[model samples]
Each structure stands twice: as structure tokens, then as C-alpha cells.
Target: MASTVADVAKMIDHSLLRPELTNEDVRAGCDLAARYAVASVCVKPCDVALAATRLDGTGVSTGTVIGFPHGSSSARIKAAEARTAVSDGARELDMVLNIGRLRGGDDEAVLDDIRAVVEAAPGTVVKVIFENAYLSDAEKIRACRLSEQAGVAYVKTSTGFAPGGATLADIRLMRANVSERVKVKAAGGVRTLDVLLEMSAAGAARFGATATAAILDDLSGRLARTGVATVRGDLSTDRRMGPDR
Candidate 1:
């Protein structure tokens, strides 16, 4: 589990990928990320340059999504998108692998699809979102294996647009399946501090969250109240959240 405020702060990739968000919203989101000193702002593709510029010197990186909610785009298009995003100052790319192909048992196609993006952005952090809501356990395991084979940096749980999101079981499964080099990221429904701490303990190293301020604020409050310099979830730290508030 994260031990300090900064440890939890840095684990979040502040999300600005909502479809209806305007440029102003993206700018504000980037500003928030910078103020919080979070890991990065995962903005829309069009906002990559703007985020990069706004977040410049803030130590927060700029990231964008590819193939997004649905991973149906052709390899060529996804690769093109990756190259364009990188050129526009995106240092991280969260890409959805071709869900249909993976479900269809087309391993080679899946690998090629992922490789296209990874190779396109040479040094950028490439995270593969499985959209696990649509896949069975077998498919999820297969995706974990293929993602490892494709040499992606992180294997992510959801795109936050799916019917279901990250669960502890999936986090554990992913962590167990992938080698130690590949980290697990949990997105969707991780809007609270307790949930984030639970997922972190389960195995996730990163999170994609739109509720950045709330989560961090809760952590800061907990630290202040307990007078603890650091915290561990498994140590039975005060459960700020209960069945009833």
C-alpha cells in the first residue's frame, strides 16, 4: 500500500478523457493534476499539446488514449494515432487492444495490433487497457500474456466506459499472470481513498481516476487526524468509511 501522501498522489493518472469535456475542462484538469503533482493527465488526443504545454515544468506528464472505449481501429490507424499523439507531446499512451480479435482467439492479430502502437511511440509509456468487462477469465489471462509478449509497460483494467470496471480479483489475476516488469493499472469506480488503498494492496500500481481531488483530500484528512506520517492498509488503519456515515 502507498505509505505517504505523495506516494498515493503519484499513483493517480488524472483523467480528462470524458467525451463531453471541453477544452476549458481539459485545461482545468491539467491544472489540477499539476497542483496535486500527480503522475500525469490522461487527456483526449486533441488536448495532448495543450496539456503538455500547461503541465510543462510541473513534473506531471501528458498522456492520451488510442482506440479508446472500443478497440476496433485498424493497426495502421492506431499506429498513426500513436505517432501523432507523441508528436503532439504525449509521453504516455493508454491504448485499448482489439477486443474482438482477442475474444475471437486471434492471438497474432492482437499482438500485431498492440505492437503497432508500441513501436510507433518508441520510448513512450504504452498501457494496454483490456476492457475486461467484455472478456471472460480465460480471455483476460490470454490478454495478460499477449500484453507481456507485446512488451507494453502496463496492463490496465478498464477504460471507464465499460459496463464494469476494475475489481480486486482482476488485479490479482493480472499481477499473477504478468511478469514483474509489467505493472497493473485500475480504472473505473476507483473514486474513493479506501478503494484505492484496497486495490493497491491487491496488486495495482497505478490508477486512472476522475475523482482526484476527493480521493487525495480524504487521504490528507486521514493523515492529519491520525498523526501518522505513513499508512498501510493491511495494518488495520482506521476505517474512515463504514457501512453507514
Candidate 2:
């Protein structure tokens, strides 16, 4: 059976990933998330505090990145960043995998690195980003399996920084590799309703998008599930860059 439009909307991760964003941007983004009850406000580590402060009473929680668009930082540094983010009110972490290490064929190094971040930010949902556009089919499969072995909560596609973002084939690949415990998020290049719905049907439990209104524009009706998106009914304003980085 096909999913409802609401089901599709709940999967979106309303984005605010720009580096030039100001505190006002962060505040507006968090406010939107709270108003719409988005899945999580994925933000910069520094802005984690700002997002958290605004969404305190609301059910929404703050999310931050580690290793970010480029996951070159040492395991130690990444772990430290995760710890600080958690302490600063981040309930979720969109940590980028050390893609270079995975591509370099140092699979163990990558797993160990994920373990380190896991250790640093225990109890927080860890969505490991594979940046799918950068990897070949085999590398993507390998990364998904690694995220499973590491016991991450979600295996995400593109950081949205690379040339391409989420693709349906990639979402299926991710779903194929991981066990039931690990969920999949299809990010990047997911603007059109067709692409978003395709991803959801392919097994994406989450979506990261900057073109939220466009997605919502195509959608019509209430969703059964709630999410942390910044889009609200009868509202039209720019969104804070949260996860499209």
C-alpha cells in the first residue's frame, strides 16, 4: 500500500545548514520546528544551545553535526565534539562518517571511529551520514553495513554538500544492508514530491530538505505521524538552514 501524504511529510528534516546563518536564523528555525513539531532541529554545534533554548518547553529537541560535511577530524576530536554537542542540549547527532577512511579501505578505522563517537554521545540518536554521492555502490553498501555493526540509530545519505544527494537506489541499498534496528534517511536532492515519496517507499524513515514548502506545497492533508520540520500550515517564511549542509 502507498503511504499517506502526511506520512511522507513527517519524514522531512527541515534544513538550516548555511554557515553564514545568524543567531536570528537559528532562533527562527527552532521556532519553526517547535511550531510544526519537526523531527529534530539539526544545527551547528554552536547553535545547538540557541536551538535548545528556544524549544525547551516544546516537544522538539536539538540536533547537531559532528565531522560535518567533511568527516576528516580525528576520532578523538569528533568524539569531543559530540560530547560537547550533547551537553549543549543536542539530543541527536548527524555525525558524518570518516568517508575518506572508508574510501581508503581502512574499514576497521572507520568502525572504531564510529564507536568513539558513540561512546562520546551515548543515549543520543546517532544518524551516521555516508554522503552517498561521494561513494560507489560497493562503498555505499560497506558504509551502511559499518553503521549497522556500529549500532547507529540511522544511516543517512548525502550531507548535501557533495555534487549529488539522496537517490532511490541508494535508499534501497541502505535498507538492504542494515538490520531492522538501523533506519535509513534519504537526504540531498530530495525536493520534488515524487522523489520524496519514492524515498519513503524505498525505505527512508527520514528526509533532509531545504525546499520544504515545495514539498509541502505538493502535499495536501494531515499526516498520521509527527516530525520536526519547520514548515507550518498557513505560514510562508524562509527556513533556517539546519540539515542541508
Candidate 3:
């Protein structure tokens, strides 16, 4: 099924995953998230507490990363991080799947790691990042299985730190492997309306991006040109949209 802009807007989980992000950056990210009505604002574990304080009662969730861009952290450490972030008011956990262990053929170790974290999160939604850019086709399918068996809510494609992130092919493949109970979150390079629509068409239910403003700007422009009443769809052909909204 094709998705409308409204549907895509409601699905976005805007991301601020940089290691050097300051308090001000986190604030700006949260503010934009509120205005855009994005699903959540994803940040590092360290910023979860402050973000929660700033976004209080806005209906935007505070999300934290576990194991982060690199998934070499031990299972015990990842589990602790999940517990701490949840206690700090984060409603979502975007934990990195341990690529090393999974690729090394220790499936049990990898599944155990994800299961342990899932056990710690009772009300929190956990989306395990598969870092799709680094995985082979077989590894990708296997990792999706582990995510399902561990009872997570979503399978994420990237950390945005990898060489490449969230391709249409990858999103489709991940969606095919997981059941309807699970969904796919595409990150790393979701920067425009067309790019977003591409992934949404391929079955992505969530998007992680740093360029939400630009995309929304384009959408607004389209709406303005066609006159909101007549432009429910196909607003691009209208000239009234102006060069800038």
C-alpha cells in the first residue's frame, strides 16, 4: 500500500545520534520533534535524562541507544544500559545488535544478549539495530530471527555511523523476514520526502533522520502551491507553492 505524507510524518522517529551532540542540540532536536509531531527523538544514553526533562508532557518519547554504533559491548553492559535509560524516563530503546558475535557464528550468545535486554525492558519499546550496511544477506535474515525470538517491537536498519545505511532493498528484505508483529525502522540516510516514500513503499514503518526540517519544508511548499483545499494530493504541479513556503 502507498503511504501518504501524513502517514510518514506520524511514523518518523527523528534521530540525533552524534557522539558530540551537546545539550543545546538535544533541545533543538526535541523542539523540532514536538512541532513536527514525530514519533520520538532518539539520542544517546547520556542525554536521556535531560531530554526527558525538556520534553515533559509533549507526547514525544525520549529514546536512548545501547551498545551504540559499535556493538562490541558485553551483554552485561548492554543490559545495564537498558535498565538505566528506562529508569531515566526513556520510552524507547534502540539497541545495536552485537554484529561481532552474530557474524562470528555464536548465535546463542547474540540471542542471549538481545533477550537479556528485552527482559529488562517491561514497558519500553525495544528496536534492535541490525546495522544493515555491514551484514550479508544470510546474516541479515538470521539477525531478524533473533530479534523476533527476543520479542522486540522493531528491527532497525542502521546507526547512521556505518558506511551506508537504509537502502530500499535492505528495508524490503528485513520486512520480508519478520512477522507482522514486527516492523522495520530505516535510519542512516532517510533525508527527503521521495527517499522516505521510497522506503515506506518498501514496508518501513519508522524513519530515523537528521533532516526532518528540510523534508517537511518541501512538503509544506507543495501544499501551499496547490492550495490546501484542492491539494489533498498531487500538489507538485501547482505553481502557487512558491519557491519557499
Model number with the top TM-score: 1
* lDDT tens digits, residue span 95-162, model 3: 99899888888899989989888998887899999997778999999999999999999999999999
**Candidate 3 ranges with C-alpha deviation above 4 Å:** 1-6, 228-245
Write out the backbone clash pairs for model 1. Answer: none
Candidate 1: tens digits of C-alpha lDDT, residues 179-243: 99999999999988888888888889999999999888887877888777667655223575332
True-structure lDDT of candidate 1: 0.92
Q: Model 1: what TM-score?
A: 0.96
Ten-residue stretch with the least lDDT total in model 2: 236-245
Flag the better candidate by TM-score, 1 or 3: 1
User: TM-score for model 2?
Assistant: 0.86
Residue 197, model 2: lDDT of 59
Number of backbone collisions per candidate, in order? 0, 13, 2
Candidate structures ordered by lDDT, highest first: 1, 3, 2
TM-score of each: 0.96, 0.86, 0.90
Evaluate model 3: give its lDDT.
0.84
The candidate that wins on lDDT is 1
